[model samples]
Target: MDKKPDHTGYWRTNLKYLLILLSIWFLVSYGFGILLKDTLDNISLGGFKLGFWFAQQGSIYVFVILIFVYVRLMNKLDQKYGYREK
Candidate 1:
């Protein structure tokens, strides 16, 4: 009989990271970009309003960073669970 791959723990960890990253994405994209735009616009970044930057560029940068972070985290998790591919 073939043994099933035991990945429940790994799956849960991945889900948790996904949720956390998504929450941050939402907050940066919507909260700072729209809801708090007026307040954030007072701050300046590279000759642009902070709020505009978040909506246009900052959130994208953060998302890219999050993707790298997720990859690193998952790799570590895989190693911990002996699930790393050769």
Candidate 2:
């Protein structure tokens, strides 16, 4: 017989990972792009200002990669922890 899962533990684990990822998202978008824009303006990426690149392009790419990475990582974690959906 399959054992009942500790739902609270599952939720807690998910919440912990979600919060951490969201915090990093906020930091890169708001912190590096907006809050530190002025400080980063002096820096350049080829011909573009570092902050502008981060705000418009870099963040998008990072976000896409982050999604894939999260999916791959969580799938592995789920398997390792026996929480994967059949």
**Which parts of model 1 are misplaced by more than 4 Å?**
1-5
In model 2, which runs have C-alpha deviations exceeding 4 angstroms?
none
Q: Which candidate number has the best lDDT?
A: 1
Count of residue pairs whose backbone atoms collide, per candidate = 0, 0
Which pairs of residues collide in model 2?
none
Model 1, 10-81: lDDT tens digits are 798889999999999999989988999899999999999999999999889999998999889889888777
TM-score of 1: 0.89
Backbone clash total, candidate 2: 0
Q: Could you tell me which 10 consecutive residues in candidate 2 have the lowest summed lDDT?
A: 77-86
Per-candidate TM equals 0.89, 0.84
Over 1-86, each residue of candidate 2 has an lDDT whose tens digit, in order, gives 98876777766777777787778888888887899988888999989999988888877777787788778767866765678666
Q: What is the lDDT of residue 16 in candidate 1?
A: 97
- Report lDDT (Cα) of residue 40, candidate 2: 88
